[model samples]
Target: MPQQVQGVIARSKGAPVELVTVNVPDAGPGEAVVRILACGVCHTDLHYREGGIGDDYPYLLGHEAAGIVEQVGDDVRDLAPGDYVILNWRAVCGTCRACRRGRPWYCFNTFNATQKMTLEDGTELSPALGIGAFMDKTLVAAGQCTKVDERARPAAAGLLGCGVMAGLGAAINTGNVGRGDSVAVIGCGGVGSAAIAGARLAGASKIIAVDVDERKLAVARELGATDAINAREGDPVAQIQALTGGFGADVVIDAVGRPETWLQAFYGRDLAGTVVLVGVPTPEMTLELPLLDVFGRGGSLKSSWYGDCLPDRDFPMLIDLYLQGRLPLDAFVTEEIGIGDIEAAFDKMHAGDVLRSVVILDGPDSDSGSTNPLEAHEGEQVSA
Candidate 1:
């Protein structure tokens, strides 16, 4: 039987999302149905609502989610009902050229559930980033469900599905920050702060955080940034160079995807240093840099997509790190609110006042049933 549940839906371009009844089909081959426990409001969701990504209307928004597997299809061998999991957007298709070349993170053929979740009247809805988790439940490709430490709170663990993972991956995976390295992260939002935390985790000796907002800078410090620079106060490139003994950092990450910030990142690093662009940029944005400088700069300039993460490899390791108190995943959750507060959360996000406003679906008034069958099981191992 298809499950009827309440979900946040963007009915049209540039319109506010509404909570509507959606019908989720039972898991089919290579799919799994998850009961979402918590889902975070991310900037991407806002982008989708505004038609920045595409004309895919009636978008089922929200993707950064953590939940439990309620059911699995017949072909889903590794996962079963009752598994605690994080929903990942990229489910790598191993037969793609990128995957065949052993770079699954760059897999061109990622997948979502074959079946569609629809509006009550049978209008097919497009799930945001293929997860569409701002609901009581969501269906995804079985490979998109990455099991992690069950002890971690849903509010915290689910964040690894998106921005947090992107930030961490920017430092550890894309930037490749190393022990005794000097690293700089620009744009101290959830992604930038996570990059700082990742740098700390990777043993970066000097971690500089640059942001326009003082509040976000403070949060960056708490996330393990050794130094903070307000971009509004001075030239971030000059400040970063001055702090790094006149050479500049080994790796500079731009977490804000703007032409100006991209230019800042270009000039902010040392010769042969890596520049990691983790921020999403619009189509109209164009970067202009001197051809001489492009030739003179002797390092790799790369863009990080979803932090170049492989769900099977990165998610569980990060969760274990979180459980051991090394990674402050909990710090990402600024506040937890009910589903009705999503609009308010978006306002807060737009105002740059919060790291993450998570929708807690376990609340008393939630439309979801109180007792989750998945939560009843004490111990079950799902192979990664």
Candidate 2:
């Protein structure tokens, strides 16, 4: 039987998201039905809503999520019901060329549930980034679920599903940040701040945060930034160089993903430094840099795909680190919101006031609430 659940959906480009009855089907072969506990509001979701990602209308728009597996396909053996896991976009297919080369992180072919989740009118909805999770329950390929420590709170644990993972992976995995390395992260949004935290975790001696918003820069400091560069005050490139003893950072990450920011990241690093682009850009946007400068830079220019993370390896390890207090995962959860409050959360995100406005799917108190628990929960703050 198809399960009817309330979900957030963007029915048309630039239109406000609507809460609709989503008909999630039972797990087919290689798929799993998840009872989502929490999911974070991400910019990617907004992009999807605005038709930036594609013309795929009625996008079910949430991805960074954590949940308990309620059912599994007959062919799925690794996961079982009652298992707590984080949902990831990259469900790498082992047979893909990238995976065959032992770089599953670069797997060209990812997995999504074969069967579609539908609206009440029977219109099939396109899942955002292949995981539609901003609801009571969602169906996904079993490979999209990565089991992690149940001890981790859903609000914090679910973040490993997207933006946080991308940022951390940009620094540690893609940038290869190391001990005593000087790192600079441009744009202190959730992703950029996570990169700062990752650089700190990797023992970066000088973690410089560059952003126009002072509030975000403050958050970056709390995360691990040693210095904050207000891009509005002066030239960010010069500022980054000044902060790094006039030579530039060892690794400069562009979390903003715009051509201008990418150029800043390019020139803000040492001659042989690495520049990691983790920010997602629109299709029409183009980047133009000097071919001479590109050749003279003498370093690697890389783009991080989902932080270049292999979910099986990265998810569990990150959750454990979060549990140990080494990584400040909780800091990312600026507020816990109800599913109804998703639209308002998008406003908060645009205002740059909150790092993440996560939808708490589980009831306020796990032991309390009516038979339909999602109805009883209210948005609440998690103290920073």
TM-score, every prediction: 0.94, 0.94
User: RMSD in angstroms, candidate 2?
Assistant: 5.3
Clashing pairs in 1: none
Writing each residue's lDDT as its tens digit, candidate 2 over 1-384 gives: 789999999999999999999999999999999999999999989889988888989899899999999999999999999999999999999998988999999999898999999999899999998999999999999999999999998988999999999999999999999999999999888899899999999999999999887667767888999999888789999999998889999999999888989999999999999999998876778988889999997999999999999999999999999999999888888778888888898877876767787899987623212121111333322111
Per-prediction backbone clash count: 0, 0
Worst 10 residues of 2 by lDDT: 367-376
Report lDDT per candidate: 0.89, 0.90
Task: Give me the overall lDDT of model 1.
Answer: 0.89
Cα lDDT tens digits, model 1, 186-206, are 888889889999999999999
Candidate that scores best on lDDT = 2
